[model samples]
Target: MKAAITLESVTIRTELRPGDIGYVIYMHGDIYSKEYGYSLGFESYVAESFVEFYKQYDANLDRVWVCEHNEKIIGFLLLMHRGKAAQLRYFIMEKPYRGIGLGKKLMNLYMNELNSLGYESSYLLTVDELPAAASLYKRHGFRLTEEKPFSDFGKPLMEQKYELMLR
Candidate 1:
């Protein structure tokens, strides 16, 4: 982690460092399994995505924010360059950190950064099971654009795509 920005009691880091990528993978794996009953498949998918992101990471176009409290990572969000647009990925906050306005703060920071980067639009894919997160996305001007049933993580789920025109 690098470049910490303190917001209240939480510190948000804007740069990705050694072992931080692995921490993200592990955090998602552990938290999702505990919260949503997701299996190892989800972890594998996250790891693969991280590998791809690592291979093509451009600091000028791609940004990651890691939120830490008491020197421990508790939340994170990623903004990735996608052609002329952008993609929001790997957004998660630990249960204890939710409902305290951290999500909204992180999102506001993300949108401001996206705007500064000149992205015209942004999109993200997530499952319908996370209603709180979906609500947050909706509040941030993202609209549900697509949905489909899938059993990718050893369970039936409605995969949803949300998009926002960032003009």
Candidate 2:
């Protein structure tokens, strides 16, 4: 049985263990499929991007927050460096962990790291289906700079990009 998700019961880890990324990919595939009807293509996209991120990861320029409860992952967020910019990627929280200030905590960490690293700009790609997440992004000063029809994730939905200029 899962314990109640108070902050004290949760461990926010910044370093990845050997199996962490694989499990994160699996969770993304499983949860997105059940909640939003995403296909294996979405899983593949996540895996591919993660591989790219790993290849170029630098502790000085990148960061990841993995939230765990009782040693099991419950949420994840990643920041990847690109030239002089950064990309906020793979931000997700388990259903039971949403609406309880966890997402905001992760976003605060992301913003602080972005500012500390002095990235000129930052952006994230997300679907319009995620209204709560979109609202969080907006509240953190990201502007919806792009949107268009998209279907690669099994269901047709509008793909959106939010960006922030930090100069």
Model 2: residues with Cα > 4 Å off, grouped in runs: 1-3
In model 2, the clashing pairs are none
**Candidate 1 structure lDDT:** 0.90
Residue 159, candidate 1: alpha-carbon lDDT: 95
The global C-alpha lDDT for each of the candidates, from Candidate 1 onward, is 0.90, 0.93
lDDT by residue (tens digit), candidate 1, 1-167: 65544458899999987888898899999999998899999999999998988898999999999999898888999999898789999998887778778899989999999899999999999999999889999999999999999877779999999999977
Q: Residue 87 in model 2: shift from native, Å? A: 0.2
Per-residue CA lDDT of model 2 for 8-99, tens digit only, reads 67789999889989999999999999998899999999999999999998998999999998789999999999989899999988898887
Candidate with maximal TM-score? 2
Q: Please tell me which predicted candidate would have the highest lDDT against the true structure.
A: 2
TM-score of 2: 0.96
The runs of at least 3 residues in candidate 1 whose Cα sits more than 4 Å from the true structure, single-residue gaps closed, are: 1-7
Q: If scored against the real structure, what TM-score would every candidate get? A: 0.94, 0.96
